[model samples]
Target chain A: MKIITVKKIENAVAQLAREANLFLRKDVLTALKKSYRLEKNKRSKLFLKAIIDNAVYARKEKLAICQDTGLPLVFIELGQDVRILGDFKQAVIKGIALGYRKGNFRESIVSDPLLRGKPVYQGAVIHMDIVKGSKIKITVMPKGFGCENKSQLKMFLPTVGIGEIKKFIIEAVKTAGPDACPPYVVGVGIGGTADYASLLAKKALLKRIKLQRGLSPACPPKQQWREGTVSGLERELLLQINKLNIGPMGLGGKTTALAVNIEAYPTHIAGLPVAVNISCHALRSATAVL
Target chain B: MPYAAQQQYCRDCPSDGKIMKILNAPIQEKYIRELKAGDEVTLSGTIYTVRDQAHKRLIQDIGRGKELPFDTKGAVIYYCGPAKAPKGRVIGSCGPTTSSRMDEFTPLLLKKELKAMIGKGRRSKEVIAAIKKYKAVYFLAPAGCGALISKYIKKAETVAYPDLGPEQILKLEVKGFPLIVGIDSQGGSIYDKD
Candidate 1:
């Protein structure tokens, strides 16, 4: 069994925060490049180029891809076989503090939702899960409020048809419009408890766009989407979303969405819940396993 | 689904397409009226910064009949709350935030003779109508490309509500600050382009 120090988690988080903000993930990069090559509207093409160039400059200059380096959404997959150390929660918080200061990432969090005082990026949105491995894995998704504000969850009767889900997803993306920095990567979560469904949606975003052939058929469907296969509903939703043509900035175009990723969980017999999590083109994310 | 692609507005556009004519703030209505949606331009001169919190305070100040920290006439308000500069940089990644978040305050600000706005995302109908009524324009600063933008800024100083931290009002001296006309004096919106 691995004896990973709490200090290691702290240090990993600090570096993850900086790296997440500064770098664009490869999956997103590939999608954007493909979109840029295929983009017809000259205006949309120019927008795509700027997105590409901005990534380049961000890497070269060692600056955040966006001013809103965002409140950290820290996901920790702790190994059940690994031995842990000090106060884990405090270590995560302190690491965020160190990262915000050292990385010069913006503190976008407010003191309270209603009170709205000074920024409080010192704290993080930490999600922990226990896994079978001997090493801990950490992922940092810097979530800017602009897109997060647009995410939504809808609870439907178990009798709800896929058509209703499609409509809800379309409405969500349309309502987001230019506001979510169009040409978004939409994460869809279906069939879980309300809160858990939204979590599933966000988790779905961590998976790369399903540009490769549908999920591998040889692999068994172990829940948590280890198989990478797209259900019929997921494929249909992706097709319909791109048809919205909300385009790059909602200024309009064909490339309204880069990709749609869906994850599902078992739900109560009477409930059907759907959640959508939208991420802008900056899609700043990074992960590390120790 | 068969689809014919619709066009989105261009911001952070090509430097080669049109020779950018610069506008210095305290912008003139005539200059604003001459602008139309989709035209790219670079702004130079002084611009005032405000975000949701500062905008609320400024509106409150107006209602209270107290003086605003900066004059509203012929003014351009930039919707941003920039990160502090690292060593040797004039400003940090200073890109625009979503403009629609300030929609409620915008029409009121425009009524006070605010001439223009610079931010990303679309504005509300009330704000667009006010831009028309006031003969002003709305410009879209590219979203998420702040570091490249900081180079255009020559100076930045906190001008009001320092207590708000990043939400503090800033008076920035900028040079060739690129933007696209997202909405024009006639209420023509770039978001509506085909």
Candidate 2:
């Protein structure tokens, strides 16, 4: 029975959009540093150094880390108990338009994909969900075009099995090579329909950059996993993916992928759908709770 | 057996100075399939800008044998879709969109004598083969280095496909634009060797 004003959402989105572009999240940065140390290829090591330097410069000058600035993808977790007081969509779009203008981020959205048309809107994509909660949560993930362009999804026969899934992921990464910008995060969505699986794959990427800083209450203690028993499937997948040696920027090194995240949903008996979404180290996303 | 020594042989290349001028204003066509592995050249001229959607349309147009909006001979095309310019600024944060997406269209363009390309990322085998056949070269500008690249562009004007917005075909005049050799006429790729 709580009324939330659209204006609050607008302001929150604007602030989040600007912040996400200018700053690299702490978890992503930490992971990058760790990868930098473990990288074996000299060229990749140098490349990682340059990436780190660019991040530092971007932060100091309050500029975007990459030119694409990405589309403003807004994930909304709306409380069923709350009603919006005004035009929520318009307010959010307005905020995004204004934020891009102020932040000096690029307007990469076009109105239509065919006939080479004009840009009717400023933001790229916005996703929303209403869930059972008393508080509203909004997350902004501004994904650059390089990694976004490399995302791939395909549905296989129900009997394709896990081995096929692994092959698909490896092929996708190999095809992506240095283009997706390496030292990247790979999110794999297994099960569900083709479209839903792809969406989940992208959603899994929105999980905050993994951290080594301290214990996460959301995750079981590390030793518990070491003892084996949890979803050992995901842990094993993580180990295999990191061993690919695609390395940073595909120059060949120790860490091609920073982490591999997987999410699953029950699917129809006819098919097994898989989608892989790659995210660079920038991992720029912010959430606001209302 | 040091890594530095291993890199030395890969980095050495012969530099040939053959300058090509892009004249007749916008939409110059240059064949890229004929260039070699280690040639150097000063590119003087006008180049058109397009990325993603434009490439898709170009492929479709070629498939349909429809007359494209511009000529393709001896042309140096730059892969970029710039932001809307503010007042008094020639262009906004203009940078190279990843070039791999354009791979499917590049060989088609090379057949028509499209000579040079400027972009980032590794080109596909089709593109490299076309470059070798047409004697064209691919140039790589630094990725994510838009702010620096914008300084080299002296003037910008929309030439064709105005409706494409940022992906519109625009004639740009650039000076001293820095780029590294990507694919040479000999079918050699710098991305793989480097």
Q: Among these predicted structures, which one has the highest TM-score? A: 1
The CA lDDT at A64 in model 2 is: 66
Q: Which ranges of candidate 1 are over 4 A from the true structure?
A: A212-231, B1-12
The clash count for each model shown is 4, 29
Provide the DockQ value for model 2.
Answer: 0.20
lDDT of 2 at B78: 90
lDDT of 2 by residue, A16-83 (tens): 88888777777777777766776667656655665676567667655666667787788888889998
Docking class of 1: medium
Candidate with the greatest DockQ versus the true structure: 1
- Residue range B93-183, candidate 2, lDDT tens digits: 5667778889988988889777778886788888888888877778765455454456567899987777766777888887656455567
